[model samples]
Target: MNLVQLKMLDAIVRTQSLSKAANALHKSQPALTLAIKKLEAELGFELLDRNQYRLSLTEKGKLFHREAAQLLSAQSYLTQLANELALGNEANFKICYEQLCHAPQYNDIICDAFRQYQSTEFSVSSGKRFASLEQVNTAQADLGIGPWFDLFHATGDLESMPIGKLDIGIVCANNLVPKRVKYKQLQDYPCLAMFESEMSFDSERLSYSKGSAIMKIDDIATLKSFLISGAGWAMISLAHCQSELDSGLLQRVEVLDREHTFSAQIRVFRQYSVHHGPVARAIWQGFKRASEQFIND
Candidate 1:
């Protein structure tokens, strides 16, 4: 009926002897026997066979003992979790990142940094630049690391900070886009882009060249697949495609009037309402450190 009685029963099952069980409980053998009888009476079942030479639980007693062990385990976990939360660990921490946030790099650095918040349940995922912000703002994520956009404004209580920048460039396979380029000239060929919004589309035209033949692909890796197959030329993060560019598989295309290499700022975002405890703040600092070391160059 109580934790004490339950634990006593557990000891009895483990020891399998009334004398041993009593020794463990620091009580007399008769006292232990009486307690077991009372417990069985309360449960309306014969928990042990009095006639058996060896101490053993009846079928029902075995089930009750299993449930008791589970209850004790649950209590222990709950107590540990409560203590951990009181000590400033997040009960559940969700972090969604932009696909280009260099997950492997963070894994090397932040994994050890997160050890301090041992009780904090942590999870990580990757998505588009906007999806990262959206996840943090909607309370789906405690934090987000994404490629920053100058025009994308994160309103409400969400706080965003620029951790670093991603170096990117307009690239074509085998220098096929042409050496002498104009914004208008690119309009003649298919341009791969990530976002589909009219403003983003307009920004694309205005930033690089005017174009309606632009294709929208949300994923950068997939876009690279298309570009490899000679689908079209598109602006992409140089950090991601450096190996291909180094091996002469792809080449950067520059406009006649503008520089070819450009960069997008990378930012970390979190909601003000999310509990930024000492551990969470420490985690964020660790992220900043990793970002700084992962320079575009």
Candidate 2:
């Protein structure tokens, strides 16, 4: 009938004794009994099996309690959110990251932030190319993590900190190309590229031979599939395809172009000269600390 009555039923179910539930809730046993009786009258069904030795829900009571539990959880969360907001925490924090930032330590950092800021809703999304930076710059995300290409540095409206480095190599399925091949020879095969039309920066450099037939694909998983099927060769992060490379499903081509093997500094960035709340500040600091640990390791 009401939260108080629903809570009483929940306590009774948990404690399995009306007296114990009354003691736990700091209410008189008679009042607890009366509340449940009223709730049953309103619901037109008994919520408990009074004849049970300890106490238990009736068949219908179990269904009702299941739904009531969700309401209680929402109430608790709302209370916590109110308290957190009173302390000046942000209501939401969004992070957009590239696949290269999916390292264990980075994931741990995000988890730690969540634990520390339970009331702050967290949104995380993975993007390709310059999408992360674009999200941060456009105020769509509170933070961004990805490769620190020259364009990212050139973005005057963003502030960035180097977190680590990503090793990328030009690779193809073993059957698609020779172990050692010239850059020009790669032109004959299609190049799988991850391109987002809204934010393509330095994308051309991702392919070793620009003359190669370009196959623009935004999804990394699909692109990897194409490479594995000898559909095309691509410049892929060593981290993303390490297992494949190890198992010989994919092979890194030895291209004459020394730059075929590329290394880019991974960075975490946010909009420049913008104020952030406690949750955002805590996450940012956590990231910086993680970056330091990463470098030392």
**Best-performing candidate as measured by TM-score:** 2
lDDT (tens digit, per residue) of candidate 2 on 103-192: 777778788889988877899987667778878865688899988876665653688777888998888998788777777787888888
Model 1 lDDT per residue over 1-297, tens place: 788788678778866788888887799988888888899999999888667887888899888888897886667557646765686565767888777656466565457756766777778876544667667755578788877775556343666666677787888787667856877777688877776322222345343545447777777788898887778897777888888888988887877766767777787878764346665688778777755665534
What number of clashing residue pairs does each candidate have, in the order they appear? Answer: 0, 0
* TM-score of every model versus the real structure: 0.59, 0.66
Runs of candidate 1 with Cα error greater than 4 angstroms are 1-88, 113-120, 149-154, 196-209, 258-260, 277-279, 288-297
Model 2 steric clash pairs: none
Q: Name the lDDT value of residue 39 in candidate 2.
A: 95
What local distance difference test score does each model get? 0.72, 0.81
The 10-residue segment of model 2 with minimum total lDDT is 197-206
